[model samples]
Target: MRATALSLASLPARPHKTADLAPGTPAAVVTAPPPRRPRGRPRKTAQERSDGNRRRQLMDGAAQLFRSKGFAATGTRDIAAAAGMHSGSPFYHFASKSALLFAVMNEGMASAVQSQQQALAVLAPQAPARECLRVLIRHHFEVLLGPRSSFIAVMLYEWRSLTPVQRRRIALVKDSYEAAWMPALTALGQQGLLQAEPGVARLFIFGALNWAVQWFAPDKGKSLDELTEQALALFIHAG
Candidate 1:
């Protein structure tokens, strides 16, 4: 009995791995929570995408009608028919014919500004100012008279058709579009190629260029290149 008790006492008790843990304390298991969706208004891109497609169709249809038929003569039904929509469909995108007109003008000016900036971007930084001016004039001609040029054409003839509030909105975009010409005109003036004050020169230059929409006949012998050359000769010193 004594030998048995001594042998049992010699065996060490198993080590207590949880000795430091307080009684009844459960181990915590951590797991990441699921991602939360943004509250208040679900994703709008999907909605805008659908609206955008229809809006673009409406604008394109309106542009064609406003170009061929005068803005005054064109109606919402005509615009909707051109776009392959019901007569009442235009009201979904635009409130009225005048609103549609404003959108076309604004879009036209915005497009013009973007194209001009892009054209200038590709030119070499060291390109001569006269050469830059020539390129800019040519780009302007292309935008004003190129295929799908009806948008600006409508803007050119329908200025008085907009309400004063609408006119102000369109003017804001127009000013930005015209401002792109300033740097090029300034460069031309510094190079002694320009004849009039830069500001006056800009007005005269645009006046002559815009008038081309009415008279210049591409079907005949007139090319955009010819117009650009003539404009340079008239505005810049030949030396």
Candidate 2:
């Protein structure tokens, strides 16, 4: 239970970018950049290439199974079978179910972050900030409440299963990303565009967005677009 508690206590990982340090920069001198990983393992044998492909296939299958069923209820053989591997095959790729869970959740979270960034980019040039926020809100729901909802589910629920170190690592990334929204949101309220309390707007906005996973049903008489419109209207009214 300690493992689960740790997972619940924090988040997962993220991508990295190289700092701009030319050969002679002070930082570069102190620490020569790590050796570049060769692009592909020096021309692997045909069997090695096939094995690498199979490992990827297994991980993908495992992710899908965990999403459809809660992580705890999902067995390693279930993932192996889903990947068309022998019953014991998942063990070759994942040391334990929690490891597999971490891999799946990490991937899904990264994808979610990417999608949100892309959605916000659409509104960057032409739309007003309020309108842009509305679009961002709607698209965020599309990912969370619609077909791509599984990642958010894992993030909100299954995180408690991670190692403490892993949990802290993920939490830092998740909170940092969440913190990025504040500047824009604060600007809106400061400019008198949104009638929201600056200090509390993030909480309310996220609460509204996250709730979509429960009540949001596709083809449930109301379309997602309509739902977005209504939600935006409600927020605007309060603002």
User: Which model scores highest in lDDT?
Assistant: 1
TM-score of each: 0.74, 0.69
What global local distance difference test value does model 1 have? 0.75
Can you write out model 1's per-residue Cα lDDT over 13-35, one digit (the tens) per residue? 43222211122233232111233
Question: What is the overall TM-score of model 1 with all chains considered together?
Answer: 0.74
* Top candidate by TM-score: 1
Clashing pairs in 2: 4-160, 7-159, 7-160, 8-159, 8-160, 11-170, 11-171, 12-170, 195-239
lDDT of 2 by residue, 1-239 (tens): 85673454334232122222212222211112244545655544433334345555665776666656767778888877877778875666565666566656665566666777887776657666577667777777777777657756677666766666556545755775576577667767777766878658778878877777666667776777887788777665545
User: Which stretches of candidate 1 lie above 4 Å from their native place?
Assistant: 1-52
Number of clashes in every candidate structure?
0, 9
Question: Each candidate: RMSD to true structure?
Answer: 24.1, 12.6
